[model samples]
Target: MNGDIKEDIRSLSLTDLEKFFADQNEKTFRANQVYEWFWKKSCRSINDMTNLSKPVRKILEDHFSFPVLHIEKEYISRDRTVKSTFRLHDRLMIEGVLIPDGNRTTACISSQVGCQLGCTFCATGLFGFKRNLAFTEIFDQVVELTNQSLHHFNVPLSNIVLMGMGEPLLNYEEVKRAILMITSEDGLGMSPQRITLSTVGIPNMIRKLADDHLRIHLAISLHTADNVKRSIIVPLNKKYPLEELRDALKYYHEKTGKRFTLEYLMFANMNDSLSDAHNLAEFCKSFPVKINLIGYNQVPDLDFKRPESGKIIAFKEFLEKKNMIVNIRKSRGEDIEAACGQLALKDRNQREG
Candidate 1:
């Protein structure tokens, strides 16, 4: 009999769980207890499941492992931005960051190892694509961050952004499932509104995401408004240019009636001119778009530099004058490569050398 076969704690759904216990000649209620241990109790080890009989606990110990990321290295910036490298089971390195403002706590989790979106200005693009993170792996990030922070601060994490190291839409199924699981009442019990998914403008995934009509915030990495310029900075723009992206945004706004946030990383003397801001405002007229003006966080591998504060203010003012909603995003964690794409633990040049 296959009654003694073990199951991966992270991979099994509630249905597979029932079959697992059934194979063991145990009642279906046994599976629910196991599932709750993962989602509710968040036990450190299988032995911590005291509700389960000793034999069942032994069975679980022989079979399952707590999907976890081992913290290999950590860096904290003077500006209070904290970034850590988590080594997965297969030696894949991913980064998680905690950015704390007075009232807001944002934890950035990586969806994939290296990104396929070779944006010219991104540091991760320099590192070739590796693999996607499983749903449980992503869940592990939230749990670990929560556990770490609970010891330091009183409040739980207030924000979760899929913006650490990879393009989330490329791994849509796992990403979607992870989000659903994270926001599930039985799971993390986090409200959907507290999560945000950032994408590099994959139209197919964008359309599907809109169809899902998830109430969570969707932020688009829109660095440039001109198709030609955008195509150079963001290669995906070739497939979904300004026109197509506008159409997608319009559809998303229409379908969900949810306002989307446009993220613009301003590079000094590159794409932060007065004309760039004007073009940006003109492009976003089709739907309600909130503009977030980000100062390009500098990385040694990338040539792009953050625009001057005066220029950024001028750009924001121009958008406001045109009756567009815009705000300047203050740069955090610049001290220790705290910029979005700068947290690359592995040296790409050294690998190639």
Candidate 2:
């Protein structure tokens, strides 16, 4: 095939690859060998598959192309957190983070270049949406972050979170494919329990996730329980109100029988009051849930301020009094703009210049 007509080899499934080899009068096992190189070995080029014959490798190179992501720039925080800006084949960019704590290292990967949801407090949405990432692009982020962890912290990546730059559920198929490859025995071989997909609460997608029964964790970014305030903070809330979201989550629990996580970003005098805690407890009543009260990471031009420590403590105490599980997640990598709600492209002008 000509370069103009060639497609990404990673886009093909095993069955498709097997058939392609057979059509070329090659042994079908060549597909198996090549598949292992692609997923299990994480080979960047067909030339890297040493087990394949030179003729076979030449044929593969002629027929297919493997798109690879390059690490354009990296920033390391004082806390030892690493943020990477990946340059795609088309020259577009996205960010991923490596967060290390004690014995565990988590790779926070993105599902899209930029976010479509314009959360007032987020920096990614300030640049507007670019495009959804392909499954291979998403997987490449994990591969690089895993390498970063071993090089920097001398430990294997213990967990993976799809909580970096975009609304994951919006890019459904690509995100799902990336997760399957991340957890598949033929791929990274990590356990599904070590992976989490965080969304800003997409009701239909939440129900669809339940039906898929992926067995990975699902997290909803519920900043507030009050609908009026939520709509102002998360603009998507007006379209998918709390009542409908509640019904969808109820259906999810009934189907999967699994506990989900609710992420609440704390902002002073905004949603950190005792009354807000009561509403949150009432919302969690419908299903088994864990609450993560995250400190607000100040983004430039965003007026949201982190709540006082006393107020956050009181709010957590109130939730615990309701017998609810709660954890206060202190902001990590704030100095490097790599914490939650802080991942975005900072050199847009330089890139386009």
Best by lDDT: 2
**Each prediction's TM-score against the native?**
0.94, 0.98
> Clashes per prediction?
0, 0
lDDT of 2 by residue, 1-353 (tens): 55487899999999999999999999999988989998888888889999999999999888888899988888999999999999998888899999999979999999988898999999998878888999999999999998899999999999999999899999999999998998999999999999999998989999999999899999999999999999999999999999889999999999999999999999999999999999999998989999999989999989999999999999999999999999999778889999999987898652342
Regions of model 1 farther than 4 Å from truth: 1-7, 63-66, 346-353
**Candidate 2: stretches off by over 4 Å:** 1-5, 349-353
* TM-score, candidate number 1: 0.94
Please give the lDDT score at residue 319 for candidate 1: 92
